[model samples]
Target: MSNFVTLLVEDDALQREVLADVLKDEGFEVLECTTGEAAELIIASTGTELQALITDHNLAGKMSGTELAHFARDRHPHLNIVIMSGTTVKPMPVGTAFLQKPFSPERLLDMVRE
Candidate 1:
């Protein structure tokens, strides 16, 4: 089993659950949140367990996915990030992976693996 841990942040309940299941199926330890604030709190509380972050570009709270990715990158430079969006937004930071919305589970897994 891989030792990688992934933090998944998505506002949509169904989407979050589906992604979580997919990650789990791939043998990753998954932590999920519906908002950036919740994701931030999880990272703050358990920074050591975090190996990567996967977030939706649009969230239900004050902070956007890009903002969360930036924050996580600031706090943990080694953490890998994958940002998913259905709409075009500001360009993502260099080196951060982007997954367009409606992406297949296999594609998402590939992004995380990369």
Candidate 2:
């Protein structure tokens, strides 16, 4: 079976494109966004079938990735969330995943595929 649909939120254009392409190649239907606010909109309107969210912790907008993830989790309790950042994190919600920056595409895929 195909992997579930995923929303990828990253402020960096190149990183967003690369991750989207990699996820697509791995049989995941991918949606891309540039900001946490945009990602929240997608999560709200998506109305199911979106299984995962991969967000950069340091987003361009006022909403950080953790904020977006929390907002999403409230509505979609089962949605898998992955937050990527170079800085240390504290008190993330249960079941959310974290990845440090500069990870390879393969490493990213491994996390998502899990």
Clashes of each: 0, 0
| Candidate 2 residue lDDT tens string, 35-114 | 99999888999867988899999999999999998998998998889999999767787788999888998989888867
- Superposed Cα RMSD, model 1: 1.3
The C-alpha TM-scores of every prediction are 0.92, 0.93
RMSD to the hidden true structure, all candidates? 1.3, 1.3
lDDT of 1 at 17: 94
lDDT of each: 0.88, 0.89
Which parts of model 2 are misplaced by more than 4 Å?
1-3
Taking all chains together, the TM-score of candidate 1 against the true structure is: 0.92
